[model samples]
Target: MNPETLLLMGLGAVVIIAAARWIGARTGLPAAALLAVAGIVYAVLPGPNISLDPHIVLTFVLPPLLYSAALESSLLAIRANLRIVIGLSVLLVFATALLVGAGFGLFVAGATFAAGVAVGAAVAPPDPVAALAVGRKVGLPPRLVTIIQGEGLLNDATALTILNVAVAAAVSGHFSLPKAAGLFVLAAAGGTAVGVGVAYLVRLLRPLARDPLLANAISLATPFVAYYIGEQLHVSGVLAVVVAGLIVGHDTPRSGTGASRLQTNAVWRLVDFLLEGIVFLLIGQQLPAVMRGLAKYQTSTVVIAVAVTVGVTLLLRPVWLSLTQAAHLLLRREDEGLNAREIAALSWAGTRGVISLAAVFTLPLTTGAGEPFPDRDLLLFCTFVVVLVTLVGQGLTFAPLVRRLGLRANEVDEARQRNEARMASVHAALERLDDLEEDEPGDAPTIEALRGRMQERLRRYEHRLDVLQSAESDEVPVSEHYESALRIQRLAIEAQREELLRWRDAGNLPDEGLRRLERELDHEERVLPDRRE
Candidate 1:
């Protein structure tokens, strides 16, 4: 594409994304699904359409998306749900690939087992982005959200590893189960080692990255660095990026100044928003291109293939979740099993995204012996169709289903926990100040002032806790005293900001000096809730 066309396409994608968001907000539908449908609509009528470059998607796109999600993810939460994550991300992927492959060989004429497995692997992992966007908006339970996040983060590695092996078998006409298994173990272990190494290396160099700009720069590059290291080592690069992100995110509080965290988060949110919109739009735009090659296959064969792929992708998830929950009970595990409704939600959340399309699109045009790869275009079409069906179908319904099932998280209980914790922390600070007063009698007045403020905050937090515990609904009542304090604080900050502006306007302060002071005040003002609202 030329510069002008590329610019136009970029602009068009943003417009579509904005429209999707607006529509989704009003309709309670997923923005991703809307963007994709918009792309498909544009694909049929378009003067210009963007084709997905598999290498670009995998290298340029996948790393940052995975890394951003991982960074937002809680390491403790992921660890707590590690078993469910592994089962869904690893074991379930393997089973889906093998089962789909076997079904194709048995049922679909001219479809080889290896080729079917490759397609199966491509579509196995649910893209966490769409599900996550909707789940968070709809207030999914914390544990279920964690499971989805952990599975999405790790499943790409499993699916891609299997896809690579399946493709190699198809190309070379050689297959060894044991060798493939060993290769998988090596890839996983090596990728994990690389990810951990990269995380520690970043920590060791934290002193050099103390400058907020420098720290954010290093943070942005860490995922790509981890990806490259894993690729060079012939390991799972996706896994490497995710692991590095998780570790880095876990260390973020202690890794840099408060300024770096604020800046880094803002940057990542923008990146994620743009990339996700562009990606799903790209997925939808591929439909016309994929279908162009479908002319060579029989209609009946194509339909059968699509049916098998989509059906298994949708059905296998719920069944697997139900069976696993049952097994948890049978084995007497510590986890309280998921009820039917939770299983239903998890099942619906298995919507696929761009990763599946990217993997299938990466299929080589020809095998090692110079013959064409069997059903390459067909596989691509099926992959695209599967993404469309689930992304739109499940994405559109997931929110309302959550509401219908009444599976939203208990916000009242959560608020009470937070306020209780805050009360405890404030009490601890008061206790420490009492110790300080004994050692530093010269600062007794300052200590007393601090103690008074701490006591006041403790009282406010206690009042909030009482409101939360007694509230029957999600809304927690704020104390009038707390509201008044917040208003006074805001008023004082505004007065200080206006005085600074007066100094700048009167030529008493330089622009740079004014900006520095403004930033400090801006950060402080952001620390409280608005009382007027």
Candidate 2:
């Protein structure tokens, strides 16, 4: 495609993404699913289409998306749920791949185990984008959210490693369990080391990253840098991006300036919005490409292949979760195990996505002996079917399933915790004011006024906490005063903004001065808690 054509395509994609997001917001459907559907619609139409380049998607696209998710995820929460995360991301992935591979090899007529395993690895990892998007909107419990996020962040690396091994075995007509195991360990360990080293290196450069522009640049570049280093060292680049994101996110608060942090965050949010939208759309467009090669296969063969891949992908998740929970119970682990409802919810949340399609699309056209890679086209079609079923089928229903399960976050409790933390912070501020008052002799009145403000804030938090404690259910209590106060504050800020605009219009205030004041108000409004909450 020419530059002009590509530019037009990009613009069209943005329009579709915006429309999907708007519709999803109103209908309570997942935007990811809607976008995928839109892409399918586009693909079936007469216009030009883009084929999914797995190499480009894996190298350029996957890193930043994983990193952004990692940055937003809570390190402490993931650590707390380490066992379940591992079970899902690592062990469960392996089991699913093996089971799916076995099913395919035995059932599908000409499919070899290695070729089956190649596709198995592709479909094993659940793309949590659609699930997490809906889960957060529906208010899933914090622990469930953490597990989903952790699994999504880590599972790609495992799946990709498995895929690579399976591909090598199929190509060379040889398979070595010991060598594969060693390779996995090396990848995991090396990826972790590279991630840590990159993160700490960024930490050391914190002084230079204090400028907002510089910080955004460094933050944007970090993921690709880590990915490149890991790949060069023959490690798992996906894991490296994720690990670096987690560490950098953890260190950001202490190492970064407020302005730089704010700017970097906004930049990343935009990056995430565009990249995810493009990726999901790209997935749908692959329909024509994947289907074109499937004409050679018999109808029964196609049916059987699809059934084996889709069936294993869907059915095995719940069974695996139940088995893991049983094992955890038998071992008497200290952590509380998942209940039946949570298990069902998590099982349904196993929606595959772009990564599956991308990984499968990377299959080599021919093996080492110059013969065609056995069942490569069939594998591609099956992988696409898995992605479509899980992505659109499960993504659309995940929210309703969670609702039926009655698995929602405890908003009242969560709000109370946040209020309690606010109270503690206010108390600390008051203590600092006292120290300042003692050290700076002439600032007594200033200190007194600051103390009064903090005292009032503390009192409000205490009252909110009391109301939350006495709530009849998990619903966050409605506070008329709090809502009215928020409205008044917003109005006051709006009025101030209008006055500044008037001043600038009259040539009394410069544009630069108006922007500086406007930014201050914007930050103030940003800090306000959402009224809908």
Candidate 3:
């Protein structure tokens, strides 16, 4: 809580996250699941434990994470599957909450219908972070990834809106379906407007954003600004963050300078790494708080409540997806329905996460008349169990399930498509260079050099295409001799870099000259694929 302790916790979290990443890579484990387990273990082991503040997580943590995800997501992919995304994000979320609420009200002792709905709303929206992390590692089909991302990006708004209404009903001892519907519509519409307005305002200030530092800074601040403005206007801040992210991400190629795009992406990756690690760890640390007042309820009650809630959460997703696919087939009559394997993967991928915990923890401590909120602690416990079941349980098994279902993407075909596009672009550029060479005789030598390099690149791409077309599997095997040539080039670059540094140190070259020369070497290295394809 103190500054010193907070600093200490921050360092510790980083170390643990680094370890999680290392272990995850080697063992094929989900980092989220591993971090969560470690947190729970630490909580029970007798050292300092951090309790999650719902306000801090909801406001400070949620915005940037959501924005980062939205920025990275493919806008075109999401739009192509907009109908399915809407079904999953909006319709599925509503259905899950209502069904869970009804079941909880009937089965859980001392739970009012409003209290049950509040808890239901908390666990309805699947968290995208864990699901995306695993899905990408396992190479899920691009369409499925887009669906998961779209659902995750937008579903929080739907669930939170429902949760707010449910909590108000519980607190005020009043409930009105019509009013809630109107409020939902108002919040959604207002949030979208705020997001669009903020994005356009940011675009108008493009002159200020040309500097890489300023651009990255503005990007970092943009989500918070959107969220705060939406909240101030009594709208859905979460939706505003998502909307802004989607729009900004789609426009980034056209709007950002090359340096700004590169720097911004690197910074956001670090932010995401730190934030996601801390969130899952905090989730594990919540066990003590969630279980504190839970003893008041019967063991059988907790068991029944958790079982029914978890069962409903898992069962409803596949059923909903199946029905939607069926409807799409029956009516639309054009788009292909998802295969059984895809449906199952998508269904299992709907794992609830931190947003659920934060929302439920925000339930009022007491009603307006000063009575204790009905079944508040019980609801908290149930919500935690739901998150654990869906997030940890499902996250840990997601990749394996996909593998068993035989749903891996065709990497070979994807690679071939990329090579074909690369070859086409190269040919177009070569044509332009020829025109320029003819028009500007003074630049003939420079143009010839450029044309020669491009033609070589064009040939390499054509060779890659031929190899891919002939290959039977996903493996892109580079010859060891070619790798040796690349290594030698890298060594030559390093030698040049060391000589440049020596010249600068000896006062023969100024720092600016050193940088300008270093950039040329940097560009050469950038052209090499340092990582495996």
Candidate 4:
């Protein structure tokens, strides 16, 4: 592409992305899907077609996107659900590939077992970006979100490994189960080791930088380095990027200065936004091409493939979730566990996306005899159909399902926890303030004022907790009077927030002051009953 064409494409992408977001917000569809459709429409036009090289996309775009997703994910949450993550990431991918591939080989005409497995592996992993974006909008339970993200992050490696093996076997006209299994283990272990090692080195070098921006730049380059190193060593690049992201994200605070932390976060956020936009837009652009490919396949074949893929993707999730939950119960007798609501949320949230598309596009174009690969276009078309059906169909219905199931954040439980923590912190602060007041009598007025503010905040917390607890017990009936009081409190908090914003705009308030006040407003808003519900 020429520079002028590239410039136009960049500008068009931005415009399309913005419009997609606006439309999605109004219609409850994912902005990614909308952006993708726009890309497809643009591609079908007569002028200057944009063709993306699979190698450039897999090497350049994917590493950063995966790293960003991994960085934003909470390590603690992943650790908590380690078993579930492992099961979904490794075991589920293998099972899905085996079953789907076997079915295709046995049933579909002109499809070999190797090609079938390759396609299955390509479509096995759900897209983390799509799932999380839609899941948050639908208010999926935090635990479910964690599991989905965890699986999404790790499954890419498994799928990619399987894909490589399948393609190699197809090209070489040979297969070795033991060799493939060994390669999988080696790639995973090697990738993880390299990633963690690179992360530690980055941490060590971070403190040597005087400028925060420079430190942030080092953090940005680490993922690319990890990925390249892993690929050079014949390891799993996906796993390498993911592990590196997690290590740096979790350990950055210890190695980074305050300025470094802020700069790093800002850089990652910008990178995340741009890459996410590009991925979704590419999805839209590929749609026309996919449809054209499907033209060669018989209508009945296309229908059968679409029906089977969508059905398996949707139904497999709920079955896996139920089985996982049962296993968790057997293994651990903990009081806290994922309830049915969470499992339901997980079942509905399995939306396939970019990874599947990228994998399909990366398939080899020729078989062992140097003849053209069979059903290559058909495989890509079927994969796209799976993504569209799951993303648009499930993404749209997710929120309504949540409401029907009465699945929302348990505010009463949250408030009780917050109150307990706040009460303890207040008591500790009060003791410290008492000693300080005695030591500095001249500053007693300031201390007393601070003490009074803290006391008032404590009282508000207690009042909110009491209301929630009482409401939970059904001792206090819903009252118009309480509702009115909540409305008034909301208005007051809104006014206070505006005042804080004004101070921020005028440079009269520090960042900390604005953040603290905003947090207070958020807490108050959360406790306020949802009138809409």
Candidate 5:
């Protein structure tokens, strides 16, 4: 691309992303969908045609985006949902691919089973970035969000495995079930091992570096190394990146200084934002190309195929979720499973994005006999149609569904539990300070001051809890007292945090100590309920 064209695309992406973010906040529609729409509008209008190489996109855009997603993901939550994640990510994807492919091959088009499977694999996995973005805005319960994201992260590998096998079958005019299954296992194992090895190596090297910037830079390179190594070993690069990210994230406390951690977070956040914008924009930009390819088929036929594929993708989630929930209940008797609101959120959060586009674009343009790939254009067109429908249609309506289902967090209960925890902790700290005052005569003034602060914090928590738990008749007076106490606690925590930062800067405390204190303050902030009514 020319500099001017590149500049324009960049500028357009900024405008679209900004507008999308604003609109998404107001409407609860995913910003990605809006970005796609904006790109499509630009493509359809009179302007310099900007086309991107699929290889360039796959190599540059995908790696960073995937890495950023992995970094932000909570490994603890993911591990907790491993069973559900595996079921949806692997088994469900395989099932969906086989069924959808068979239906297409036998009924819709005069294609081989492998060709149908290819299409199925291409569209199977939901986009994690899109789903999580919309889900957070729609107030999806934390557990449901974990399940969706975990499934989304892993399903790409399953779909890709199926796609590779199908593509080989299509090329060689042969299919070996045993061989394919073995390859899938080998690839997964290879990726996981490589990721784990590289993650440990990165962790080992991180602490030797003194500068925060150097450590942050080393962290950045780890993902690409994991990805490239996996690819070199003929394994799943995506999975390798994910595994590496999880390892590093879990081990972050070991290597990262507070400054380094903050820097790394900011860098990844920027990378993620830009990549997401670019990915959606590219999806929209490809519409014209996809349409040109679909010109060979009757418009009605193409429309029906697209509609059926989309309907299957949308309907399959709820059906599968119900079955999964039923099985969980039978096996574990857990009532904490998804509620109706969460189920609805899951159903609507299934938006397709970059991975589907990458899979479609990666399809071969020529067949074994040197002729054009059979129905390649139709496949791309259908994929685009499905992406557009899910992103725009379901994305727009998700928030209203959340509101209708009354899925907001229980603020009163949350605040009360937080206050109780704070009261207990403060009481413990006061006792500890009393011991310190008796042990050291010279430190008596400092210990006494600390005890006074702890007492104040204890009173604040007590007052807040009392207000929240009070009878309605006394609520007004209790609430006023609670607000006053809360303000004092907030100010105290802020001051404490500031003092800790100064101590670290003055070399009076280690970076780890400051980080631990910061974490405590952050926990306090989370516990303090949003007072915005």
Candidate 6:
């Protein structure tokens, strides 16, 4: 395609993405699924369509997306659910691959066990983007959200490693259990090390990245650095990127200033929004490419291949979660474990996405001896089928499933906990003011003024907490006075912003000065909770 065509396609994709996002917000559907449908519609219309390049997706697209997710995820929550995360991310992926491999090897004609396993590996990891977006919107409980996030963050590494090992075995016509296990171990360890090293390197450079622009520059580069270094070292680049993101995210609050944090967050949000939307569209557009190689295979053969993959990929998750949950219940003395509803919800959330397509696209056309890779085209179709089925089918229905199961989060309790935390922070501030009052000479008026403001904030929190605790239902009780106060504060901020704009328009204030003052108002407005009265 020419540059003009590419540019037009890019712009077209943005338009579709924006439309999908708007529709999703209104209809409570996943934008990812919507974008996929739109792409498919466009693909079938006899126009130029984009084919997914695995190298481009893996190297350029995957890192930043993973990094952004890792940054937003709670490291502590993931650690708490580490066992379940491991079960889903690693053990489940391996088991699914083995099961699918066995199915294809025994049931599907002319398919090798290694090639079957390669397809299994491709479809193993669930992409958390769609699920997380819908889950948070529907107020899924924090524990469930953490599990999904943890699994998504870590599972790519496992699936990609298995895919690589399976591909190598298929290419060389050699398969050894011990060697495969050894390779997986080496990749995991090396990737983890590289990720940790990159995170520490970032920490050492935090002082230099204190400026918002510089911080964004470093943040943008961190994932690629981790991925590139890991790939160069013959380790798992996916794991490296994820690990670096998690560690850097965990340390971000302690290391960066408020402005840096704000700017970095805004940048990553835009990156994630654009990248995720384009990726889903890209996935749908590849239907033409995926279908092109299936002419040689018998109709029945293609149907059976698609069924084996779709069946194994969809059914294996719930069964695996049930078995793992049972095993945990049997072994543990603790009263805590996933109940039936939680398990059901988690099972339904296993929607595959771009990583599956990217991994499969990386499959080579020929083996080491120059023979065609067994069932290469068939495998691609199966992977694409699996992605389409899960991403669109499950993505669309997951929220409804959660609702049917009566699994919505307790928002009132969550608000109460947050208010309590705010109360404690205010107490700490008051204590600090006391110390400063004793130490500082001739700052009595300023300190006293600060103390009054802190006291007022503490009172507001206490009142909110009291109202929350006294609530009779799960819904948060909205105080009219509180809502009115917030609205007034918002209006005040808006008026100040208007004045700043007016000054800039009249040339009384420079653009830079106006921007600086407007930023202050933005932050102030951001601090207020949205009650949407």
Each prediction's TM-score versus the true structure: 0.94, 0.98, 0.94, 0.80, 0.83, 0.98
TM-score attained by model 6? 0.98
TM-score of model 5 relative to the true fold? 0.83
119-181 in candidate 2: lDDT tens per residue?
A: 999999999989999999999999999999999999999999988999998888776666766
Q: Write the per-residue lDDT of candidate 4 for residues 199-289, one digit (tens) a residue.
A: 8787788656447878877877877898999999999988999998988778765776765676677788888777787877777678666
TM-score of 3: 0.94
lDDT, model 4, position 414: 55
Lowest-scoring 10 consecutive residues by lDDT in candidate 2? 173-182
Order of models, best lDDT first: 2, 6, 1, 3, 4, 5
Using lDDT as the measure, the top candidate is: 2
Each model's lDDT: 0.89, 0.92, 0.87, 0.78, 0.76, 0.91
Model 5 stretches astray by more than 4 angstroms: 206-210, 253-255, 332-336, 339-341, 413-444, 468-533
Q: Which ten residues in a row have the lowest lDDT in candidate 5?
A: 471-480
TM-score of 1: 0.94
lDDT tens readout by residue for model 6, 1-533: 99999999998889899999999999999999999988889889987888899999999999999999999989998988888999899999998888899899988998888889999999999998999899998889999999999999999998888898899989877666577778889999999999999999999999977899999999999999999999999998889998999999999989979989999999999999999999999999999889998999999999998999999988999999999889887898463679999999999999999999999999998987888888889999999999999899999999999989989888799999989999999999999989988999578799999999999999998998989999898778889989999989999999999988899999999999998888889999987986721
lDDT of 4: 0.78
Best of the two (1, 5) by TM-score: 1
lDDT of 5 by residue, 25-117 (tens): 886677887888888998899876556566676566766776777777789998887877887888777777776677666666556677767
What TM-score number comes out for model 2?
Answer: 0.98
Which scores greater on lDDT, model 5 or model 6?
6
